[model samples]
Target: MSDALRDRCEELRAVVLELTTTTIEAMGKPSKLADVVTVIGKLRAIGDKGAAGIDNPDYLAWDRVYDASLQKMEDAARRGDAQEAWRAFADQETGVNLIARACTGYPGW
Candidate 1:
């Protein structure tokens, strides 16, 4: 990968980690469902953008996983299931790390 692509991959990973951490922290309080959903939406958008230039199968696979996990997180948040939402968010985080590794040869987490 070029330096630019590797840098983009790192940026994507950082964004994912930040959003996941924020969502997890917000789960401890009530009325944070909207915030969590918003973060997940951002994550989905980021994943879509981040995957656009990649041709690696592993990166693409994990990108899809990240997208699906974001959807699951959003659904769980809507249902007021904090536990499930957290679980999905964790999966999203893992997906992000895997994608970073696949693309940049480093676990950006």
Candidate 2:
């Protein structure tokens, strides 16, 4: 992959990690809505960039996991369960590993 795409992917990974960390930390603990909003914003931004290097099944798996995580997070939010919400979000970050793996086969065009 080109350096720019690699950089973007790295940025996405960092955002996912941060989101997961924050979510885990917020579990059963007080959390600021602003923080959650910011994380969600970051997630949306990264997703909007498109799955440029995500052509492999691994990447597809990551996407599926990500989509599932989002659903769980929304459900938790609806239930007003802060801990569940955080935990689900944190778990979602695991998909980043799949994303990275998929990127390894990118054409880097």
Instruction: Please provide, for model 2 over 1-109, each residue's C-alpha lDDT reduced to its tens digit, 9 standing for 90 to 100.
Output: 4565566566666676676666655564545434555676677666666666545565556665675666666567556576777666545354345555655644431
| TM-score for each predicted model, relative to the true structure | 0.69, 0.60
Model 1 global lDDT (CA atoms, 0 to 1): 0.68
What RMSD does model 2 have? Answer: 5.0
In angstroms, the error of model 2 at 82 is 2.7
Evaluated at residue 4, the lDDT of candidate 1 is: 47
Q: Write the per-residue lDDT of candidate 1 for residues 1-109, one digit (tens) a residue.
A: 6564565566677666666676677678646877788877766776777666666666667766776767887898888887778777655345454654565564554
lDDT of each: 0.68, 0.60
Q: Which candidate comes out best when scored by lDDT?
A: 1
Off by over 4 Å in 1: 55-58, 92-108
